[model samples]
Target: MKNTTDKQLLRRATAVHRDMLKQAEKFGVSASQYDVTKLLHTSESGKVKVLIDATERLAIAIAKRRRIIICEK
Candidate 1:
């Protein structure tokens, strides 16, 4: 059961990461701007937390960029 739980967590993390990357691309944010190398060595829970934090940061950046673009127009 623990193994199954771990797998689920990993899957969720991967999905979140993929979505975050797609959103970043849409906003013209380079993937290289975020450091994900450490994720591989982190625990499953840690990976999720890190990814969630990164996603929130990306969302904020995208919002700011949109506001700037709207103001420029």
Candidate 2:
């Protein structure tokens, strides 16, 4: 049961990450080049922040599953 839920979460996160990349490309920038904080509108910034946070959390979860340590400075 837990494994199934994790798989679903992983799928969702992958989809979101792909979509974000596509959006950045539409703006003539790669996902790594896109700056979420530079958005002029507060709401848009907040929404992007939430998505980024979720994606980070998902990455951490995946790393843990593989017994990998993610060091943050």
Candidate achieving the largest lDDT: 1
lDDT of each: 0.68, 0.49
* TM-score for candidate 1, residues paired by index: 0.66
Q: Write the per-residue lDDT of candidate 2 for residues 1-73, one digit (tens) a residue.
A: 1467655664564477666556545544335533333442455223544556755654444445345332421
Q: Considering only N, C-alpha and C atoms within 3 Å, which residue pairs clash in candidate 1? A: none
> What tens digits encode model 1's per-residue C-alpha lDDT throughout 21-70?
67778877775556463565655347666776776777777677778778
RMSD of 2: 14.4
Clash count of each predicted structure: 0, 0
Clashes of 2: 0
Candidates' RMSD to native:
2.7, 14.4
For model 1 the local lDDT of residue 37 reads 38
